[model samples]
Target: MGWPPASAAAAAAILCLGLLASAWAASAAAAAHGPRALAAVQPQPTTHGGLGPRSRHHRHAYAAMMYMGTPRDYEFYVAVRVMMRSLAKLGADADRVLIASADVPSDWVRAMREEDGMRVVIVENLRNPYEGNLGGMNRRFKLTLNKLYAWSLVDYERVVMIDSDNIFLHNTDELFQCGQFCAVFINPCYFHTGLFVLQPSMEVFKSMLHDLEIGRDNSDGADQGFLVGCFPDLLDKPLFHPPENGTKLNGTYRLPLGYQMDASYYYLKLHWHVPCGPNSVITFPSAPWFKPWYWWSWPILPLGLSWHKQRWDDLGYAAEIPVVLIELLMYIAIIAITRLARPQMTKLCYNRRPEKQGALVQGLIKLAAILAMVAAYTIPFFIIPCTVHPIIGWSLYLFGVLAFSSAVINAFLLPPLAVLTAWLGMVGMLFVMAYPWYHDGIARILVVVAYAFCSAPFLWASLVRVIDSLQTMLERDPYFPRLSEPAQETEFSKLF
Candidate 1:
């Protein structure tokens, strides 16, 4: 038997609440351990002793750092996991270490150590001396000063500090054989800090801290700038050539560009033609918004697929799938309930409006409605988990945008097509940018610009239509009769 309207709505509402509760429960469970307590947890030492006698005497580690300051911390966590797992899969004879801030969830720490085979060193977030001086892009690097903690990892003789936005094309074990301080000069003068090798020494770490205290000449107020300030002579250092006899070198050395291949280079030639050293790692040092882990970055940054492939192979997205599924179900429930109850909802919403409201009041109401529509599109874009596969990510986004937009359309009594023009335009722009046949990045950017130019007129027309519809709604008689008059079923109610 078909269910009654009220009963179906009650059931859907209950389902929505239950899904929300589940999501909250999952988050609460992950954060069960208090941050202060988690911060006090000691660094776990590596005890996995399967890497032959070299593991006994010569300790080496591949280390990365994580701190929570931005909205995208979880995405970086996933990226770190995938990179560390890829390193493990390459059968590197070195330990994988994560220098994470104490505030990072204990669950994330546990997963990294127990599942990804990483040694966890929980440390306090390092204070950025250049914090007040930072502006624009430099502000995001405030907590990046924590990367200096790599030098405090005294347990390992040699540590390769890497950023999370790197994909391992091959094992970089040979990097451990380099000197006390080594880095690749992706630029002509300054070395890229995305990946660097350093020998652990408390003295060096202390000296770096002192430099920060003295307000050293840091160009960007980030670790990259501070390190560049500290090691100003690295660019002139002799290029590192790993000895066949396995003798470790001392002093600073410049690494070959292949050790840290910029992902942008591939777009130029569409191939890995790096001639120096080994083409071992690909780093995304481009726009922060277009990081490899973000789903929308794939077709635009084709190497992003390689990152996802490593993730699929080593660290599966199983941990992220449940939340995504729950959100999807909630969105579907919302869309269904709104569709089923639209007529009654519209009548109830319209009945309460005063017949003689002022023009200022009406204008404010119209402005609010417009703002609601704008939020419907944008707020969903930020809420979706960032690292899901492109297909799943885009699907969830479309569903979310539709679900939110539907409510706005029903509430405002506007034409659906006009309301959806922005969403359609966004999809069109994405298609323009994602076309795979572009000869280079320049061609792709040009095509996207052309598409935007062509679509702007239609988008402006749609906006005008939406505003006109709002004005018509304000001017026309109310859909429902006032409380003084006897209620009568209108044609809209009859159709429902």
Candidate 2:
């Protein structure tokens, strides 16, 4: 019995060595080929289906493009995640696909795949043939030609290519049953490319590439104009009505106006009144600055709240909170230090005699001071992240202004009220834009214009006051009190 037990132990040791050898070999291969090798062999969680070879059978996909050409790329990434998460929550029976540029960070791609349950297709940024011809075209559309990659996604039977600015109010799975190509006419003549259905075909994709290479008559040098050029006859096509039997249509068709309800429409009636077809999606095809994801767009465009709500419900602001909190803390520290150490900062000012400086030099100095105050107000606005929560965004902005304005006040010995007029005006302007009882967008715009007109004189008065105060301080017998002298506490220091 002892001999038999020893033999069994030897066999177990041999088996253990074999398993270790296999694991070591796999790890070595992964080390040699890098993360892609590991990604290939890694077993994905069952909730997120494996990225193995997809079935050749027809499938449907909801696709959007993410390219890194713009300053607001991160904001758009957040928007795309919210949109994809919304589609997943709506129980849409289609793959959520992101056509990302090759340069998109690996971690972002991994996060979208693992966290958002998205299939990412990495593609090269398509070159715009009309780059030189772009006279009045929006330069942001330079990489938009990459949208043509949608046609290269030949794995899907039907692909609904959508812009990130879209908020899905309802399931759009029925769009797959419409046709090989279908788009809504948000404008009278041109179809809106914000959301459009297309049947992916390599042959068609190649043809498009050929057309692009040959310098085909693309009006706007963007995907919208290029596609419009390709399908010029879409306006005349019959309207699409999804067949109850679920049969996919063959030809191009015009999707109902309701499919791409412009957000502007809701502002007109203060509610959705699109009776053309099912009001499934809302698109912000207006000015680029007014995209719904922006925190400032809320209340100005009431529909923006809906998009924010979706973002909150689906992809919470957890990722943004850390940065926002850090910024808040930094601003608070700046304000506190500036207030407590005002005397020390004031001592740093120049002490040149009034006779030494020429009139032109003094005038230039005052102008420079005014410009510095302007920079203090405007710089903070651009530095803050674009898509943070409105509460956090506005609060950070206010704190940032105060901190910078305080520094300006201490350095120049200017009156605080004159220096802070811009901050106060900004606050008042926000309230004006957010007034809820406006009859329509036009009324709201007119009211804002009128408010600006009314406030102009006051602003000018503040500017003049700032200049006069600066002139007085510069021409004083002693420009700033000597550091050797006893510190005299002024009203500014007392208030702080």
The window of 10 residues in a row where model 2 has the poorest summed lDDT is 41-50
Off by over 4 Å in 2: 1-52, 55-58, 135-139, 344-350, 479-496
Task: Kindly report which residue stretches of model 1 are placed more than 4 angstroms away from their true locations once superposed.
Answer: 1-58, 68-70, 101-104, 122-130, 135-143, 152-157, 209-217, 244-246, 269-271, 275-277, 348-357, 478-480, 487-496
Itemize residue pairs with steric clashes in candidate 1: none
Q: Provide C-alpha RMSD values for all models, in order.
A: 6.0, 16.8
lDDT of 1: 0.77
TM-score of 1: 0.81
Q: What value does the lDDT take at residue 255 in candidate 1?
A: 93
User: Model 1: per-residue lDDT, tens digit, 201-319?
Assistant: 88898888788788888888889889998899998899999999998999999999998999888877656878877888889887888998888786777777777887888777775
Task: Give Cα-based local distance difference scores for all models.
Answer: 0.77, 0.75
Q: Compare the candidates by lDDT and give the number of the best one.
A: 1
Q: Candidate 2 local accuracy as lDDT?
A: 0.75
